[model samples]
Target chain A: MIVVKFFGIARIKFKEKELHLEASTIKELAEILAEHFSVKPKEFKQFVILVNEVNINKLKMFRTKLVDGDVVMFLSPASGG
Target chain B: MERLTEKTALIIGCGGLGGYVIEELARVGVGKLILVDGDVFSRSNMNRQLMAKEETLGKNKAEVYMKRLGEMSTCSVECHTHFLTEDDADLFERADVIIDCVDNVDTRKLIAKLAKAKDKCFVHGAIEGEEGQVMLVTPDSKVFDKYYKSVDDTIRHSTYSYAVATVGSVQANLAVKALTGKGGKFENKLVIIDLESVFVKTIEL
Candidate 1:
């Protein structure tokens, strides 16, 4: 299971702190999450996805493969000052 | 600390995070400060802004902080009583470090681009409710684009005093480190603070 977490506005929107899911890649995870949370798949684009505390963008992005026991976080940018 | 007396920091915005950043920079002896913010203090800002007080209501944020810091510190503080735009590009050239404490995403993107163009270290800070994020962007880093590319500026996020102060302090710390040649660790990394969960973590960007 991949341990998924949400932060900032994503947390507020999902109303869930964390969840455990099974997925092979970030793209698959996003699809599952979008369906489970009742949001559009495109909404995940607004989040910075991190796997094991490293941004997926620094890796292969949505195509990055997930592994068991990996920690994933979806974080939205905080624009307020 | 003595070395800080010769460094300059240019800060954009004088609201919640900006207020704390200015206070910290002033107290720590940053020799010069360039503050820009056209907005004035209002009743709504009293809850989070450090310089926003009853006496400062209706006063221009930049000007008010200039006067407040001038009286308390020996640092030379200059302010532009207007919002930053492309015309303010020259201001970035004059400072050793640039800070973004703006409330809007468009302005933050502009600052990031300007700082990158000028090869200046940019310290970005923002707070929403119980969460805040601080990132140090070196001239070559593309962290801003990666983090804010999909952010919706039309949406406003609620901010609190504690989150503002915490993030602002972290921003100041990064600025000081950049000025003092000790900020390599922060490059390409984003620090996220969650007051509700009481945890602070750094994610490699």
Candidate 2:
């Protein structure tokens, strides 16, 4: 099981701050949230996901196994000056 | 300056995003601050800019920002009152962390490259319209080339909104986290926020 923190729009969508899921990878984690949140490509829920603060892309998503203490955080991209 | 102890930050703009980032950093006891901006507060900046006001219009952002930040803390706050361009490498050299609050991409590129060269931590926050995004880059990452994309790219769009304050706050959080050396987080990744969709996910670049 991994603990994921929702940020920005992610927080607004789920109406919950985070999720504890028994998943093996970031991809699985994303799919779980996508299904739970029912996100659509049309809606454009474009956020950069990080695992332990490092990008999930750096690891194997959906396939990235987790240890009991591992942490995941979902975040929104900030476009500011 | 002693209050910050181990943390020192350089804010590149005293505008919208910069104002909020500075407010939070100073509030949390960032020891030394260098506020760099060549522009003055303007009427158009009143929308979402905390430091921008009708009476403050035309006033140098660096000056106004330093005055406000000083009141926020007794720590050292230095105002450059000049743009953080290629010429500001000296200022960048002195920062332990650099928080970007400028809207233009070219300037972003300059600071990004400088931070990389100096091996400093760079925290970036951007907003266009109702959309905003934040990302962290280190001496080893090329995280912002996407922002320099053509003028029409989605990355270049920014908006003014009080509802979107969280986005900038997150960027500030990322910066502080890096400064504290508390852990390895917000490194080499972009956090995108679209208020319209109400969902956030991390896209690996």
Candidate 1 lDDT over B66-165, as tens digits, reads 9998799769999999999999989999999999999989999999999999899999998877899999999888778878877657346677789999
List the lowest-lDDT window of 10 residues for candidate 2 chain A: A40-49
Best by TM-score: 1
lDDT of 2 by residue, A1-81 (tens): 789876544565567676788777666667777787797532422555567766656776446666765788765543346
Instruction: List candidate 2 segments past 4 Å from native.
Output: A1-80, B1-3, B146-158
Q: TM-score per candidate, in order? A: 0.94, 0.69
Q: Where does candidate 2 chain B have its weakest 10-residue lDDT segment? A: B149-158
Task: Give the candidate number with the greatest lDDT.
Answer: 1
TM-score of 2: 0.69
Clashing pairs in 1: none
